[model samples]
Structures are given as structure tokens and as C-alpha cells.
Target: MTDAPVLPSHAYVPGHTARHTEGAFDPIRASVREGMSSKELARTEAFRAGLAFRASGHFWEAHEVLEPVWMACPPNSEPRAFVQAIIQLANAQLKLRMGKPRAATRLCQIALAHLDEVRGEVVLGCDVAALRVEVLALSTSSELQYNA
Candidate 1:
């Protein structure tokens, strides 16, 4: 295991952050309107925060923050699939942290499947090709390391 990255004050990581006992961070307090454009959705604070949480090893919080953005996207659209892939990635990491390697591998496979639905090389700020490679590696790794 490696040291966790420094996260924003408002970011909450379950078991690691004291603030989680009070309440999980809710980046989306209300339902997001459906049919929002991918560019517009990508610009939202929730999306940015979600990515930040994931990068900081706060996988649970990242999934919580990104779910609304995923819900807001048009069904079957590349943006929806992209967000779903990210959410699955977060879940995969969380499962790894929980010592559930089988679950993590399954989730990584699901994430890769979702990635296939995306049409662009990049979605939002994520490099789709790079993400695919990362997820595939995670799925096959026998000994994975994670941050706190």
C-alpha cells in the first residue's frame, strides 16, 4: 500500500476521513436534468470533484459524486457510457481496497465493457485508450497495491 494523496478539505474518504461520520459529501444535492450535453456536464463541479476523489484514492466518494452526472446523461449516449465506465472504475478500486480481488476484477471487466460504448479517444478529461489499458491491467493483476 502507498500513502494517499492529499485531497480537498471538502472531500470525504470513508474510514480515512473523520468527516465521513458526519455525512458523505454530496456533490449533487438535487436531481440533475436529463438531456444535458456532455461538454456541459463535464464542466460541472460534481464531475471535476469526482475525478479528483478518484485520483486521491477516495473511490467510494468518487462513485457517489459521479452517479448523478451519469444519471443526467442521455441514455445510450457516449457521455453516459463514459461516466458509467468511470463509476465502475471507482467501484473496482474500492473493491480492491476491501480485499475483494475477484469483485475488483469483475468490476474492471464491466468498466471495460462500458468503455467500449464510448466513441471518442477522450471523454471529458479522461484518455479513453489509456483508461482501457489501466482497467485491463487491473483486471489481470495478481497482487494489486492501493492507497489509504
Candidate 2:
């Protein structure tokens, strides 16, 4: 998806009209930057804000917030992959909202690929294994409903 001209005050859901405007302040955009460890990144307000946005169905905002965390991690690192998986999941949800099941499924596949590199039960406050299962279901399910 293309970046919004400005951060919208309300969450965007495709096919549904919502008034969008500029001047919305985003903490992640204001403060998040590269050069942080996974652990440190997790502790940052920006990371928490990303999670909140994702949980609140603000998929685009979530992606915007989390991208910096992904970039901060070393290339090919588990932390980077994990963060990317989450971002992909958010994007997949956005695609689903846009009524593009094929695109959503494809995004889920990409998320799964990134998740495969992640180890352990948890990372950055998420259950990696559970997330993998959920993404797999989304990738294969006939009904493309995004349940958060």
C-alpha cells in the first residue's frame, strides 16, 4: 500500500469511507530510529505503539510504526525476521480489508517464511509459535476474515 499523505486520525478500512486528514501525531514516526537491539527495541514506546495499533485494527499505522524496529535489527537476524513477520501480518490484514484475498494469502505466505527463521516460544512480547499457526491458517483458509 502507498504511504498516506499524512497520518490519519482514524484507522483506514478499505471499501469503507473514512475522513482522513493531516496533523495527526505519531510517536513512532517522531522518535523511532535504527541502531537498537531487539530487546531494547521491544522496550521502546514506538514498539509498544506498533503493537497497540495492530491490536486496535490500525494495520497501516502498525506497519508504519514497526518498520523502524525491523530496520534496526541486523539483516537476516531472527529479530528482524520476527518484526517483518508481524509487519507482513498487518499488511495481510489490510489486504483482507481491501477485499484482496489473494494478496492477503500471499502476504501470509511471506510472513510464514519470515516466521520460520524465528526460534523460541516468545519474542518481543508475542508468542512466535502461535503467530505462525495463525498466519498459516490465514494463508490456507477459504474465508479470508481478519480477526485482529
Candidate 3:
């Protein structure tokens, strides 16, 4: 339902850790689980690992790893938003490296949208203001410079 295409709950999303169960686990619940520390599965470690990968500039690698988390996130949940933002961020970075500035800018915008719902500056890059600035600059530059 989001503007972003909903990728099929693939039988095997490359970087996922859990089985793709439909309507089973919720992202907000999972995020709370990670925070509470009393849940059966400690997801904080897993999330931290993914963040580390993203920070290290391994966008594609981050995509591969964080996807399951995104898929697992239920609608209207922080986990869903967080994973969505991370995935969008990684995809944008990948597109940038591929020289597709338009695609990159759009993806960055998607990330910003997700960031708007819920975020931590230390965790999500100090909010979406910076991302908005970057994406707008790229989009404007691309639009003005390339009209072919």
C-alpha cells in the first residue's frame, strides 16, 4: 500500500534471517522486544549488525541483510519504518554508485518519508532533514543539467 512497491514475501529474501511468515510477527512488537530485553529472540544485536554494515558503506550488503527485518515488520510499526528507511537508504546509495542520480534521489526521498514517522538521530542519521537536502540537491541538479 505504500508508494514503494511491496516486494513479494520471497521464499528466500537473500539477507533475511527468519522465515517469511505472513501476518505472524509484527515490527513494532519486534522493536519493543529488542528494547525490553526479555523477548525470546534478541533482535538488537541483529539490527546493530545491519546498521554497522550500512555505516560501512556496504549498501548492497546491507540490503541483503536487513531485508528480512523489513519484510517482517508489520504495517504501522516502527520496525517497519526503520527497516524501510534503511533499505531505501541502501538502495539510494547503490543507485548513486551506479550513476542513476534520479533513481537515487527518489529512493532517498522514500527513506526520508519513513524516517519522518519515527527516528533517533544517532541511529537514523540525525533525522531526515539532511536526507531531504541531499535528495533535493541531487534531483534539482539532475533536472537542470540533463534534459535529454
Candidate 4:
């Protein structure tokens, strides 16, 4: 079998670094909120796994667990964005563990924005607005605590 094509890394760009590509969050939100996609986002085993991992401070594992759910989402669905935001939040926590608070903060900011798309709606068994506030407070804090 032929090898898959290699994608370029974003490391070469300064100040343009992001966990996800720019402008990719909006469509996902619109799709979910508007019911543009048929895929229903239930709190499945994978979702539970991600939550468990995040709660246990296994941030990277949480990201891994939630990714498939995000991928299974129909393109531009709110569920997709919500999962992606959770993944981003996990990533931010991981970055914080790695002593990169700035990166973590930035990722949290992106996550908060994504969360804003469906603030009042309960998706993935979470109060999206409350989570947004928590993340926002974390991002804005002078120092973030681990497993916070």
C-alpha cells in the first residue's frame, strides 16, 4: 500500500498557531443549531470516556477519546463544534501541564468561542453556557490550576 500524503506542520508560522484552522468553528455551530445535519449527538460511550479522562486530568487522552465523536458528526454540525471545543479544552489542559499557559489560554479562548455557538443548549449532557463561563474564567485567570 502507498503511504498517505504528509500534511504540512503549522510550526513554521509564528503567532498564527492554533489547535484548529481559523474560521472552521462557525459552520459547525450553525449546522448543529439549525439541524442542518442528521447525525444525532448522544452521550455515548466515547463521550463518557472523554469526560472521564478530562475529569481525571488525562487531558490528552480526553482529546483522543472525543475526536472520533467529533469526526462522526456531520460537517458543520453543532455537535461537531461542541466536541471539537471539548477536545480543544482538553488540549488546553494538556498544554497547561506542559507549562505553556499562553498556548493553553489561547486554546481555551477558542473553545469558549465555540461554546458560545450553543450557549444555552444542553449538548453532550453539559450545560454549554456554564461550561463557557468556567472556561472563560480559567482563560482569564492570572494562573490556571491543573485539573481545574
Candidate 5:
């Protein structure tokens, strides 16, 4: 069978990441403000928290926090798949964080399917496409083979 892809460790070399963190946080904070009501805000806050966890390399925490939101999204819509994709993607991320890139790559394929099916621009502030490109870079990298 064909092998899954892996990313190089140098993927984050574009620039200093922390400088861009504030811009990333803006939409999340906006989402919290634009929520329909307190309940909505609460839910959005949970998602924002999950994003923070994901950014911090705590993929399991991201998964635990995001899975419910993904699962709770209305059954037949882009947002549902988006969240579900995030959950699945987070699982793969957790695998990567734990140094199991092959398993992570497998999970990423599942996550990619859902993410690809999503419509319009990102429903939330999360940059799934950029994340996809990044993950794809890692998943397809030769460096991950033996490490896997």
C-alpha cells in the first residue's frame, strides 16, 4: 500500500509566529462578541479556548474541548462538518504531538475529507486551509517516515 505523508520540522520557518498571534486572536474575540446570546458566547468561548490549546501544542485538550462543539453542530450543514473536521484533525494533531506521525497522517486524511467539503470561507476564525497546507507539508515530508 502507499504510505501516508509527513511534514518537515521547518514548516514554521516563514517568520516569527508570536507577532501574528494577535491577528489570529481578533476573529475569535469578535466571535465571542457577535454571539447570538450568552449561551452562544459561551460556546464560542469554548471554541476559542480550543484553538488556543491547539496553538499551544496541546492537541488532546483541543480535541476534548472541540469534539462536543463539532458533534453539537446542526446535523446537516457546513459548520457541522467544519467542527467535526476540527475534532478529527485535532486527534491527528495529538498523534503528531505524541510523535506518531503515521497514525496522525491517517487521521489527517479523514479530517481533510470533511474540511474539503466545507463551503464558503472559514465559518470560524480557524484557518483550516492554512492548517491543511501546513499539515499536508508535514504529512508529505520524507523526514516523518522513519520517525513514524
Candidate 6:
């Protein structure tokens, strides 16, 4: 078979739409994903920043902070799935904050599905089981009081 073209590191990630192409091959994103694969997920500043934003009730910012790391991971990889789960969790919380319970519930379910692929394992320092418990509560509740 002919060899695949040697695209630059800046080439678009597979499955990303054109709108998601900005900085698609960031070096920092690659570094963070590499670190996470070696148990350094919690040590990465970007991951920690996303966690901080999530804990402080800034879900949209948390999603933005974590998205690059997720994007950096190879398709269908565990680290990618974990980061995607966390991003979905962040969006679920944002939906709740916006008073859209149905959308929040759907997002929470999607996040749980991603987390299940990891078999309740820790992701970026988050205890997946504990997070699942909280997310399940959020899914069922009509109101949320996050970190307030």
C-alpha cells in the first residue's frame, strides 16, 4: 500500500469539522494527553485548570479548558473517552445552570455512557464512581445547587 502523506503536526485531527480546526494540532495538547497516559493527568496544568473551573461553577469555561486535551487524544482511546466524559459533564452542569433540565439530563446520560466505557475508573483525578453518583442525582433532580 502507498504510504500515507506526512502531514504537518498542524494538520486537522480526524473527525474534526472545519469549525473545530483551529489549533487542532497544538503541542501543549499533545503533551497533556501524553502525560495523562502515564498517570500525570492530575499534574497537567490544563487539566487542573479545567477541574478548578468545574468546581467553581464555571462549566462553560471548564469545557473550553479541557477540550484541547480531549482533541489531542487518538480516536477511541481511553484517555480521549475520559476527557470527553468530563467535558460532557461540564456541559450538563451548564445546561442545568441555564434552567434546561431535559437537556441537562440528556447530557448527563451521555457523560455516564462515556464514563462507563472506562469502567468507573478515575479520570484526570476525578473519582468516576463518585462523579457518577452526583451526576445521577443531577439527572433526576429538578433543581441543582452546585458548590453553593
Report the number of the highest-lDDT candidate: 2
Predicted candidate 4 versus true structure: per-residue lDDT over 73-125, tens digit per residue: 77765777788788888888778767788888889988987776664477766
Which segments of model 2 are wrong by more than 4 Å? 1-9, 18-26, 145-148
- State the TM-score for model 1: 0.79
TM-score, predicted candidate 5 vs. hidden true structure = 0.64
* Error of model 5, residue 99, in angstroms: 3.1
Expressed as tens digits, the lDDT of each residue in 90-132 for candidate 5 is: 7776666566788878887887788787765756655667767
Q: List model 1 lDDT by residue over 1-148, tens digit each.
A: 1133235555443464544543445534242456667877877767777787887887887887788899898889888898999899999988887777777878988999999998898887778998888788887776553421
RMSD per candidate (Å) reads: 5.9, 6.0, 10.3, 10.1, 11.5, 10.8
Model 6 lDDT per residue over 12-111, tens place: 2223312234553343244365434525655565666666667677576567567767876668776678778788888888776666667787898898
lDDT of all predictions, in order shown? 0.75, 0.77, 0.55, 0.63, 0.59, 0.65
Give, for candidate 5, the lowest lDDT window spanning 10 residues.
Answer: 1-10
Listed in order, each prediction's TM-score against the native is: 0.79, 0.80, 0.54, 0.66, 0.64, 0.68
Number of the top-ranking candidate, with TM-score as the measure: 2
Lowest summed lDDT over 10 consecutive residues: which window, candidate 4?
1-10
Point out the higher-scoring one by lDDT: 3 or 4: 4
Global lDDT of model 2: 0.77
Which residue pairs show collisions in model 4?
28-76, 32-78
Which regions of candidate 6 fall more than 4 Å away from where they truly are? 1-38, 144-148
Candidate 3, residues 7-119: lDDT per residue as tens digits?
Answer: 32332323433344643323422433322321211244335445555666656655665665555556676556766877788787667666666677788778878868765
**Which should have the higher lDDT, number 2 or number 3?**
2
Worst 10 residues of 6 by lDDT: 5-14
